[model samples]
Target: MPRRLIIDLMRASCDVPFVSLARTLNIRPLLEARGAAASPPGFAAVFVKAFALVARDEPTLRTLYVKWPWPAFYELPRNIAMVATARVEDGEPCVLPQRVGDPDRLTLAEVDAIIRWGKEAPADQVPAFRKMLLTTRLPWPLRRLAWWVGLSFGRQRANWFGNFAVTGVSAYGGGELHALSPGPYILSFDVAKPDGTIGAMIRWDHRVTDAALIARTFARLEEVLNGEIAAEIRASRASEPKPVRAIGA
Candidate 1:
């Protein structure tokens, strides 16, 4: 069925104890610099790298809780982003995650290229889609069993599903109050207001952390966006070739 994969994904997401924390961020500086870039990167790419940078310094954001093999926390060595991307399957629109590992270590252009690949490439060509499709085509009982085994094992879970997700409906002109994912952390953001503030929410597995840490993470996200992310945009603009002057003005 076209919807079977999404159904299984939701089923697994339901098992996690997710909690959300929302904040209004002022990122006018980054937004302005991005608007001025010769070729601006997508907001999804911007948010992905910004969050990964923050997670790089905060171990809690990169930690996950493992159920089977005894309940315990699993902390990844680097940030793996599972970014939700839209695709059409058999005349039906479906969303699949594009995994970008160690995004914090990559440039904004590199991250954008990977996200664009997930969007434009055929489903079979994308590793996440290939894996999900193959599993979805399996018999119902076996499909469910695969999800259980993958989710129960900490290392396998991280490799297959990733540790954090970045998703939003803002491009559709609205914010997502809550987005579901199988990762330990999920970040959703809305369009900016006239005052240049945007509503951002971070829904995380409470089993791994609490509100206080998320609150602090938000502050760091703002800083990274304005500091590192914004700098990248400006740098890109500066690196663009200057226009040739006319013989006579």
Candidate 2:
């Protein structure tokens, strides 16, 4: 059944110790530039790249607590984002995750295109969706085993799930209170306000690091969004049609 997928995910998530931290980010500059762009990238894409850029410099953001053969921390080489995208499956709506690897190295436009594809593409066509369907179809015992193995392993976990996740309910008029994910980091952001403020929250695993690092990461995220992310939007305007000059009248 469609519900089984989320149920399985919840079962796996319940085992992790997740702590959430929230902050209001001022991104008026990025908002203004994005609004003027010919094709504005989705907020998810923008946030994904911004967070990844911060993670690129902060290894703590890239670290994960794995309980496989032994309990230890595993740091990924790059950032992988598991973005939760809503889709209609069997005539019912469901949220499925789409993976975007090394988002820091990707252009905002590139990340947006991939996210748009995940939202618009057929559920069966999206690899993540298909994989989830297959896993859920397995017997209960097998399903539990699959989740355990996936969560226990390090590299396989990153490749299968991701180092972080992005999910939001901003389109529905608010943000998620405590969004859960199997990854070490999961970020949720609300709609941008007229004054350029947006509600952002990160629910991270406690076994990896502490709040001080995440606080600094949030500050750096705001900087990246206003700096390089805004610059990218302005760059997109280069392709805009130049205003015609009137001849002397």
Candidate 3:
């Protein structure tokens, strides 16, 4: 038998409530080979950007619910994204947080690049990851205090955790319909079929919004992925280089 060293759970320990939801979009006909020589953004970036863009019109998903001191909902201006990224740490595979602010305005290529840099860079060099490391290094009790203060009061929550989070399960080769997150909106992207159909799952804090808003988000997501986003990706083909796969890609 081997003795194991137990570690404190950092972000996972936060007591946030979320309502699980899922939407299946039929993107089959959208990918009918237009002879695109360039590679498109990874599924994760596509979903993240799509959500941010959709949020511009809806605005409901952009609101966060803060409890403690005084219960309230806060609306954020920029669509900051907290993407779950896998990186190498201490010669082992570890998942860290990679934040992309203003993802709504950034092109798909740019968003893809930032996420790639987070995955490729060392944990100490990446600011988001460095902060995560520092917070987790604290004793569990202190860590809880910090999370409580940062997440429940002022603009620290959006600054620290971003407006929303994204995680993917399809890279593991299964079409998952849910992933855990502790914020207003966390999206889980499933596998894409050759026909272009993909599964999208959302976990949202219903205190600020509801299932109706998420349903609209799903519709807008499919719209951008197959419409405007698709056009942008096609345009990138003229100067496209090698593909940059996201973490777990």
Best candidate according to lDDT: 1
Alpha-carbon shift of residue 120 in model 3 (angstroms)? 0.9
**Candidate 2 residue-wise lDDT, 1-249, digit = tens:** 568988888878988899889999999999999988888999999999999999998888888888879998999998999999987877998888898999999989999988988999987787877887898899999988988888899997888778889889887897645888889999999888898899999999999888998898899999999999999889988776888999996
Q: Which model is ahead, 1 or 2, in terms of TM-score?
A: 1
TM-score of each: 0.96, 0.94, 0.86
lDDT of each: 0.89, 0.88, 0.74
Residue pairs in clash, model 2: none
Global local distance difference test of model 1? 0.89
Ranking by lDDT: 1, 2, 3
Clashing pairs in 1: none
As for TM-score, the candidate ahead, 1 or 3, is 1
Worst 10 residues of 3 by lDDT: 1-10
